[model samples]
Every structure is written in C-alpha cells, then in structure tokens.
Target: MRALFCYFSATGNTKKCIDLYQNYLSLSGVESDIHNIDDGKLEFNPEDYDMVFFAYPIHGFNAPENVLKFAKTLKKCKEKKRLIILKTSGEHLRINNISSYSLIRILKRRNYYLTNEYHYIMPYDIIFRHTDLMAYNMYEALKGLVPLDVKDILDNKIVKLKYMPFGHLLQIFMLIEHPGAKINGLFMHTNKNCISCGLCEKACPTKNIEIDEKGKVHFKHSCLMCTRCAFYCPKDAIVFGLFNSWKVNGKYSFQMPKEEEVDKHKRYCKNSYNRYFKIAEERIKNQK
Candidate 1:
C-alpha cells in the first residue's frame, strides 16, 4: 500500500517528527511519498494511495490555516479510508487535541473517516512562551516508541504508564479559561534592526505579514501566535510584547550570523527574483 505524507511546518519541529516517521516507515517497508505544502499545490488521486497522513503544528490552539484549507479541499474527495492526523504542539498532547477535534469534526461531516489521532509536544511558540526541558525530553522519548505499526504499542498496558498522568493534566488545563482578558486586536511592528529580510513574512504560516504600499512591514490579527517570524528573524526586529518574553529571555532566540543577513533595502526585490526564477525553472523542467 502507498501512503502520502503531506505536511506544513514553521519552526521545523513538525518536519523533525515527519522525518522520524518517514525513517520508521522506510525501515518497515512502507512505500510513501512526502511533500512539503510550500513546494506546490497538491493534486493527487486518492485512489492511488491507501493511506494519507496530515502532519502539521498546532497554532493558537488550531491547525495552521493552510493545513485547514488542505483538509477542507481533501474533504471533497471520495476516498473512504480515514486519514491519519499527526500533530505537534507546544502544549501537552491532550490539550493538542483541542484543534484536532475541530478539524476532525469538519472532515467527518464531509464523509471522511477519522483514523487514529496522535499528538507530539515541541517547544512553545513565541506567543505562548513555555520552556520545560523535562517535558521536551519526555516528548522525545514517547516519539521514539511510535513504530510504523503502532497498534501493538497502543495495546500495551505500559503506554498508559508513560503518558497518562501528564496527558490528563493537560486536558484539565485546557478547560481553564485564562484569567487575563484576551486582546481584541493588535498589530506587529518591526524595529530598526529589521533588515527588511522578508523572512518573517515567508515563515508566517498564516500569511498575516505583508509589505504595505509604503514598503513597511505590516501584520494582521490573523496571526496564530506561532512566532515563526520572531524566532527565524535574522535581525531580531519583530516584537510581540509580553507574548514574546520567553524569546527576550533567550529561550526561543535563534542567533543568525552577520554574513547571513540580507540587505534591508533589497528584501522584496531579491525575494521576488528568487521566487519567480525557481518557478520558471520548475516549469521548464516539467515541460520536458
């Protein structure tokens, strides 16, 4: 049976899990094709594959907007088998299901079967700002146990011993409302350090950041709080106030070298050149 692994990743944590899964599948002799959602539009015949894997990071307690759109599009297909949703979240796995549950309800209404749902934990996003190294280590250990054929592991009594208590606590925490009132609206701004590198816009999964007519970076309320922009920023210009304090504390900071910095004035023009040139090359090769 063939499988299709479709995924969206921002900080590469989800990609890391996908890589591990792909490696396990290969060792188990499973035939699969992996695709990055950014590479191109997915146009596949579901009849050609026996299983489909939707892997994505949970953002703002929801699946990234792009992944949600992909799921909606696939719902129109007549494939009968349930799709596997492998999600990675900054929170514990139990709370992670909050978003997956919403997506599953949508797909089910469209006649798609909901197969097994799995959640893995990763470092918190810049918005949520959590840093528990112990939790991260436990998450890694659990991931190592998920074999290509996970039924056996699922049936084992020891599974509960490993993940139950923490999972239950996460679920309980998900039910509690934040004491602080939610912000109705906000905007992100870049400081002078912004090299105008455009990496923030490119890394944003929701496409919420854009260059305005005056050539200044602007953000919308659609941000998932994933902090891909702040974390990946070459110049460390993007700021989100208290939401990004963990980064300020150096937990999520990713230092880039001076040589890697892009010119502030040439950001958009250079990005456009690279994007179109790559597209042209792909078109030419496909025509052959």
Candidate 2:
C-alpha cells in the first residue's frame, strides 16, 4: 500500500516518530512519500494515496494552528479516503487526545475518514526540559511501540481515543493558544549570546524569525509557537519571551548516558509520567 505523511514537526520529536514509522512501514513492504507541512503547499492529493498520515506535535492541548490551516488546504476528496493521525506530546495527558478534534472535523468534511490514531510521548521543548534519563526513556518507548502501531494500521484495525464528553468544545476553548502563541512570538528576542548567525531565521517553521540588515533578530506575529527556533538554536540565543525561563534548549541525545542519575525534574509530573511509561512498557511487552 502507498501512504502519504503530512507532518509538522518542531524540535524534531514528531519527525523522529515519523522516521520510525517510515522505517517500519518500509520493512512491511509499504511505500510512502512525505510532505513537511511547513514546506509551503500541499502538492499531493489524498485520493492518490491508499492512506494518509497526519502527524504533528500537540500544542496547548490541541493541534497547532498551522496544522488546522493545512487541513483546510486539502482538496475535498472525491472518495472516502483513510487518514491516520500520529501525534506526539511531552506529557501523556488524556486531554491531549483531544488535540485532533479540530483537525479531524475538517478532514471528515472533506470525505477523509479517521481510521487509526496513535500518540507518542516525546521530550519537551518548552515548559522545562526533561531529564536526560526521562528523554531517553520516552524516545525508547515510542521506538518500541511504532512497529506495533504500523502493523495494526497495515491490518486495517481501527484505533481511536476513548469518547470524551465535550471534546470539541474543550478544544475550542483551548484555541486561545492560537493568538497567545503569536503574542508570545513577538516577545521573543535575542540576547548578547546571539552571534547573528541567522540560524533561527532559517529554521523557524512560520518564517517568524527574521534577521534585519543590521543584524537585529525580529520575531513576527505568525509564530506557531513550535519553539523550534529557540530549542534548536546553536547558541541558545533566542529568548522565548515570557516563557524564557521554561525554554528547553538543545536537542536530546536520546541515548542512555553511562552515569544516568539526572532526575532533577522528577517531581514535575511524577505520577502521570510514571503511569505512562509503565503502561507503555506493559503494552510493548504484550505486543512482543
């Protein structure tokens, strides 16, 4: 079967999950093409592929505004097409399950039916960095689960989140992040650490970061709040405005460090994080 992956990955977590899916799906004899949603326009039609995967990182309990806009960009399908959602979040909160509420509603109107949905827990880019150990664990767990999820999709299984009352309404309420993100982007500025390398300008998904002719970095209102400009900044120069204190800079190694005792943020989301890892472990073991 052929598949199309239309994904928005900021900070690489979602893209990393997509990479795992692509590798496993290829092993299962499926050919796939990818379209990074940030790369301008959608050139592929959903009807051309057997199945389409909509993947993104959950932002503020909902899909980012760009994802919603991308959904609108799709041409209405002539036939009932299958679409699967693959989302990644730093925390494993059920509220995040509602992230797809708006996206699915738009796609459904276009005649694309939701077949399966999968969630992956990945390292955080904002609100505080996860411990290296936690990052390693989260990445490893998702790696272990990707194959099983691919197999389920290949088998034509239907997997979806449990029914949540007022899911759509709750997601609508969370839409405040759409504007909040823009305002926050305006607040983003560079400090003395900025060396005018212009990396942030080139990496911003929304083209929100612009380096003026005078070497001044300016942030525009189009920011999707993906935090890619700040998180992946080589010099850690981009201050994330009001959320600067919570900004997590640097890419995760996703490697098990030899001395692994760094658990400074262990109490941040202890119970929920532990429960997610434990459940993921059980599920992986069962799948084996």
Please provide, for model 2 over 219-263, each residue's C-alpha lDDT reduced to its tens digit, 9 standing for 90 to 100. Answer: 988988888988888899988987889898999998887785767
Local distance difference test scores for all models: 0.58, 0.90
Give lDDT tens digits, candidate 1, residues 1-288. 577788988777787777777777666666778877755467775557766778888765566656766767664556475467777765453334566655665666666565566666555554333334323443444355455225432232222112243544453354232211123115457788877767777767667789766757888766655566777777778766446445522233222223443333333334533443454445445544
Residue pairs whose backbone atoms clash in candidate 1? none
Model 2 alpha-carbon miss at residue 50, Å: 0.6
Cα deviation of 260, candidate 2, in Å:
3.4
TM-scores for candidates 1 onward, in order: 0.66, 0.97
Candidate 2, residue 258: Cα displacement in angstroms equals 1.9
Candidate 1 segments exceeding 4 Å error: 38-40, 127-139, 148-186, 212-215, 220-222, 246-288
Q: Alpha carbon lDDT of residue 245, candidate 2? A: 91
Clash pairs (backbone) in predicted model 2: none
Native RMSD of candidate 1 (Å): 13.7
TM-score of 2: 0.97
